[model samples]
Target: MTRIFNFSPGPAALPEPVLKQAQQELLNFRGLGVSVMEISHRGKEFMDVAEQAEADFRDLLQLPDNYHVFFMQGGASLQFSMVPLNLLGEKSTADYLNTGNWSTAAIKEARRLCDVNVVASSEDTNFDRIPALDTWKLSKDAAYLHITGNETIGGVEFHEYPDLGTTPLVSDMSSTLLSRPLDVEKFGVIYAGAQKNLGPAGMTIVVVRDDLVGLARANTPRLLDYQVYADSGSMANTPPTFAWYLCGLVFKWIKSLGGLTAMAEINSRKAKKLYAAIDESNYFTCPVAEADRSWMNIPFTLADAGRDGEFLELAKARGLLNLKGHRSVGGMRASIYNAVPEAAVDALIEFLREFEKREA
Candidate 1:
């Protein structure tokens, strides 16, 4: 059996051990005599998986008792709207930081529901760096201060979170969740699409402070209400049973690797190696600033844009697949998510050198 190094941003690579375990139990699912995909979400088999997933997740994040973890279906995009729908309370505006594509999208969705205050932005620089927190002009009575923990398309991340005295802080952590240790108490709410560092695309993980619940607007859909999901234990509907189960396995896999602290060290080392290769080479350039570069996604461009297609083709043939950057930005992007191994990064670096030599 052969598996190539996969670098696609979403639906990214998963821990190999977890994949192997799933393959071994795909049909039987630990003596249940049925695939997890075919079982009832309310049954003991799947319920146990759901409960364990929440517990392991809570352990990994050290979540406070005031926070409630909801395993919902809509991806992070849905939370963009739900954040305003549920948390807006009586405020007419929300503060948002426009960093890159994802942040911009979040802001766009939010604008539809309430008056949006773009507190600060790095769009002027094409999102090569995160805007300084001190420069943010937060509204006096805003609903919440929103930020994207990491921008996947632009390869920029915020290493330090901002402190919003009395206001609640909300973040879209889709691409960077679980990549490092986060202060669960710092943000009032945190949401992530499971595709990046978790299990798959169908699941969305939301950690909302208990106080933030029970405030949805009257017109909010029942499924979009945070309180409903929280009260129902994230089982308001059938839920994504198979995706939830897989995510539980991933949480266990992460625990086995010594939790986020260990994962953070590995991710930092991997990003350093890849960034070093880009910085030391004259043939490639990373647009994002050094301080703001993302540990998971590193987007770089060849000195000659004409060679982008050629580089991608050769890299794929050599077993490095899905290295293409997002269409909005034309270049090469290597998304080294939590499951991507260091050896794969080394292989990519080796290919970079070979390609540079051949093309130069």
Candidate 2:
């Protein structure tokens, strides 16, 4: 009956309307006698749900006809290996931008399969800012250029995507997908874990260009092969039925709110307000650079690290939950994903002001 502004990043908060609709339909989905979770994924009813979800997703991103969308089971972490296993055809190198933790993980996975070329990295600065694109030393024949659209842990984001002329540009957009409008044609592949913006933790969405399919290595597992999933319509195995259905409902909810353009406006407004509060207050500090700060995840630090526990405790007492930052980078993180309303951000900002007064 009661819900706090839940913001624990992945498996993050979903829109309340979507949750309510799911609750209403949980027992019997749209007049069916069985729950959506109990239905057959291959059945016509589930098939229709899958098809419509893909369609709405394509509409949201305005994807071109050449792209094929696959609803896969692996999380975005799996794509770190899948990208290299499938895309690094013949070429021994792939260009990666080491912007933060996620990108570093992707690079490490790629290294196991191919020679990774880290073209640009912000690690020298402790991942506080994105390396300038012009400073990159790209390989002439790298298989694909990899980038993380948003670094959830470090709270850094790439405002503009790199222009990799001939090479395929692949991105791990796990944290920022569907938060705003994107040019689908700009990249050869885009993969996102569903938990952040899509739906639940069990599903991953992959959008790959037609030209990029059918190139998996000879030893690649059938399930791990992009072409295999493409051929079977992402039913290479029994997909996560419940997660897929919830994602479909989420897609529908997003469309009802006027699609990505409107969603972007809302996200931008919320981020700007939250960032302004952090900037104006000496009590809190956002380490990420202004130009590179993530609109989805905002990690900040209290003036005194010793007071971090108190801040989280008081914030939770006041109805703000999951404000703890990642373990690797200790502090506080406010993951304001699509489901997070503007009022939640306003409430958090007000809480920050009050907490500061009490602690000071």
Lowest summed lDDT window (length 10), candidate 2: 1-10
- Per residue, candidate 1 scores C-alpha lDDT tens digits across 126-216 of 9999988789998999989999999999999989898788799999999999999999888999999999998988999999999999999
What lDDT score goes with residue 46 in model 1? 89
Pairs that clash in candidate 1: none
Q: Tell me the whole-model lDDT of each prediction, alpha carbons only.
A: 0.93, 0.92
lDDT of 2 by residue, 1-360 (tens): 678987788789999999999999999988998899898899999999999889999999999999999999879989999999998888789999999999999999888989999998999899999898889989999999999999999999988886778899999999999999998888999999999999999999999999899888889999999999889999989999899989999999999999999999999999999999999998999999999999999999998999998888888898899999999999999999999999899999999899888877
Q: Tell me, what's the RMSD of every candidate? A: 0.8, 0.8
Model 2 TM-score relative to the real fold? 0.99
lDDT of 2 at 33: 84
TM-score of each: 0.99, 0.99
